[model samples]
Target chain A: MKLRVKYSGQLRTATRCGEEDVGWSPDRTLAELIAHLAERHAAGRPHLLSDSGAIRPSLLIAINDAAVMANEANATRLRDGDVVWLLPPIAGG
Target chain B: MEDTGQRSELDAAERNRYEWQLWVPDFGEAGQRRLKEATVLVSRIGGVGGTAALQLAAAGIGKLILAHGGELRLNDLNRQLLMTTDWIGKPRVESARRRLRELNPHVEIETIEANIDEGNAADLIGRADLVVSAAPLFAERLAMNRAAVQLGKPLVDCAMYDLEGRLTTVLPGRTPCLACLYPEPPPHWKREFPVFSAVSSTVGSLAAMEAIKVLAGFGEPLASRLLVFDLRNPCFETLPLRRRPDCPVCGPISRPAP
Candidate 1:
């Protein structure tokens, strides 16, 4: 399946693009999606997941317009045509 | 005539002020009447605060107390709707009070011509059912949050930049306070940022809507969540937030509620 990923603010600068189309598998989650991109796009980047495979606090992840709470596993089981948005905690007034 | 709650007794003519809202499913004459009884304090009527306060007053939130210290300047007209070109040299609170009272005479308007701070935050927040943080600086924002937390008042924080806006509702100790989400004011958060009047209005309206929902028992109040908007790309997002264990104002204190 295919999933569309979106980015904004300062993260867009680092990702070097606002959005991308990526291949997906039903078995995967948001953490898997970013892992795939981080590996494919840029090597040596700090992994998004912890050693225990949890989303790191520095990065904020959203699935289909909802922010992931710290306690919840942001990596939900993926479905075809899912929309994902990634944004780091950027500072603003 | 029923008390309508506040001293501002609803006359036969003023009853028509809420005809549309009163006809809604759950918000009938009683709910509309409930709104007329609630009091909201808007801290520092500026870009975001002025717009939110205006909406609350126009929506007939019975009593509104506005706190703002600065005098209006030509530069403030960009996003401040309460100030007009004619009011440039006047104090901001005066213009904000005048515009708010003019919108609905039924709304009892109170003015606090002082900036909210650690010293006086509680007294101003004490009188209101809900509070709006429209003040520019985070020092003021932090003060408002602390006051709201101390009083256990639901706080609606409206903020905008460039063409984007973000809103979040703080349910005192139940949800995350401003300090939880932002541990401290960011170094880059300057007083003036790129903002459009429409964006400020948009955030302000949403803030007022949240206050309305909290006050009248309407829809979801966005409790414990942060709603961020990017009008440039028009993306609306909500992030679930939990109280930080070490947030200064909202952090862990080994004491119970006073």
Candidate 2:
């Protein structure tokens, strides 16, 4: 499946993935996709995952336009032309 | 219709001050009167809240309750527009009040020099018809969310980092509160992050507009939707937000009584 991943905030600078689509195998879960992105973009690994190799709790994953909660993210599957937004919490006022 | 006449009449000065915006369709003198009668609370009047409060005052909101702690510092000048260089050592809320009052003397201005916390969240939020949660911490944001949910008031949540910003409107039982989006603060979250006045003000202005729409009953509001802007790529996306049925803050309140 082809997924278009949009990196938000500091993640964009860290990942260097701008306006490009990433390819992944069928039935790839949101967590696996994030892990794959972390692997591909080594600089963003720390931001995307924790030392325990889990998708960081702070990372917000939106499939299409609906936000997937942290607990449900691993079970959520991606399909062709899925648009995923990797939003980090931006607390600065 | 019973109280329409009593509620919709705007004074001569108000009519003149909001002349340009009064031209907006569905938001004529009646909308202006709604704005004149509304009270909005903007917590932590810094980059985001300060701009939100300024726009609210410009729109002639009846009362603005501005809350923020600490004296201004040189570092805050880049984004805290309400704080001028001369007022560096002064309290931020006082400075914000002075500037907002200068802009719209007819609008009532109230200031509190303390940031939102458990001690004062209920009292502060209870006093306003609407709330703009521009505080820089999740704890403060969650406090505001809880208070808003409990009080059944609308809240506009705004935040920014570097060139990105996100906004969502919470209508208590109707839309998702901040806690529903992030059950707990992100592990990587920090108290301070990269911020630009341009980005903060952009979100702040949008938040203020959301508040105006909610108060004046004109344009469509961002309720149950999250709008994210990435200024680096100049991209804007509005995503649908769902209320978490299990959300501790809003879930129980939305449940039907047995």
Candidate 3:
């Protein structure tokens, strides 16, 4: 399955790209996808996940424009052609 | 929330000064009255809070409680609109108060020489009907959020990073608070981020408008929605938001019936 991944704020700074297309297994939970990206972007790994391998609570993961909260990321399943948006929390006034 | 019940009547000068906005179909005399009665607390009068307070004053808000601590530096001149070059070494909130007063003398402005923190957040938020959380740190924003949620007042959270800005309105029990959105501060998040004046001002102005809508009950507030815009790509998007049931801060507040 092919998915479109979008990045904004610090995530864009880390990933060095606004967006990209990724081919992944069907029906993988959002957490798995985040882990996959963590592996792909080795330098940005720490920014994506915590020491416990949990997607950092501050990183907002949205599947198709609906934000998945920290407690729900593992339960959120993605499929072919889905759009995932990763936004690191920005508090700049 | 109880503040709306006591909307102040607009005087002749106020009505004349706000004549154009009074022409707005649903936001006529009543909306103007509501704005006239509102007292909003804007945290850290920087790029975002300064602009938000300016807009609110121009829109005839009755009072503004400006809270920000620190001396303005040359670097802040790029985006902190309320500050003047001459006031570089002065307090930022006082600058904001002076600028806002110059713009709308009819609107009362109060300046606080401190930033929002867990200790003072509740005390400051306690005095206002609404809040604009524009502090440059997660700790400050979350502090304001906890106070606003506990106080049952509306909060408009605004943020900017480089060319991107985002905003959301929190209606306490009716919507998800900031804690629900970002359970914890981002690992690498820092106080400083790239900012363009235009981007911060844009988000600030929009946040002010959202505050107006929430106060006057005229337009649809960004309740349960996040509006994100990136000037680099020139795109805007609204993403749906949900309340986290386990959100410790707002979890105990029962939602009112529709």
- Which lDDT tens digits does candidate 3 get at residues B121-227? 99989999999999999988998999999999899999999999999999999998999988887767888889889999999999999999988888899999999
Q: Which parts of model 2 have CA positions greater than 4 angstroms off?
A: A18-20, A42-47, A56-58, B1-9, B255-258
* Candidate 1 residue lDDT tens string, A1-93: 988887654445457666888888888766667767767655213424445645555455567766554345444776777777765443222
For candidate 3, lDDT tens digit of each residue in A26-76? 768888889999898876677788988887877877888877775677888
Judging by TM-score against the true structure, name the best candidate. Answer: 3
Residue ranges of candidate 1 with Cα displaced over 4 Å: A1-93, B1-9, B251-258
The candidate scoring highest on DockQ is 3
What lDDT score is found at residue B132 in candidate 2? 96
- Candidate 2 lDDT score at position B147: 95
Q: Evaluate model 3: give its lDDT.
A: 0.89
Q: Fraction of true contacts kept, per model?
A: 0.15, 0.72, 0.93
- Candidate 2's error at B220, in angstroms? 1.3
- Show the colliding residue pairs in model 1: B162-B194
lDDT for model 1 comes to 0.74
- Give the clash total for candidate 2: 0
Question: Number of clashes in every candidate structure?
Answer: 1, 0, 0
Report the lDDT tens digits of candidate 1 across residue range B170-228.
88767778877655454434676667788888888899889988888878888877787
Q: Assess every candidate by TM-score.
A: 0.76, 0.92, 0.96
Write candidate 2's Cα lDDT for A14-74 as tens digits: 8776546999777678888888988988987877888889777557778888788766778
Q: With candidate 3 superimposed using the best TM-score fit, by how many Å does residue B60's alpha carbon deviate from the native?
A: 0.7
Q: How well is candidate 2 docked (DockQ)?
A: 0.64
| Shift of residue B163 alpha carbon in model 2, Å | 1.1
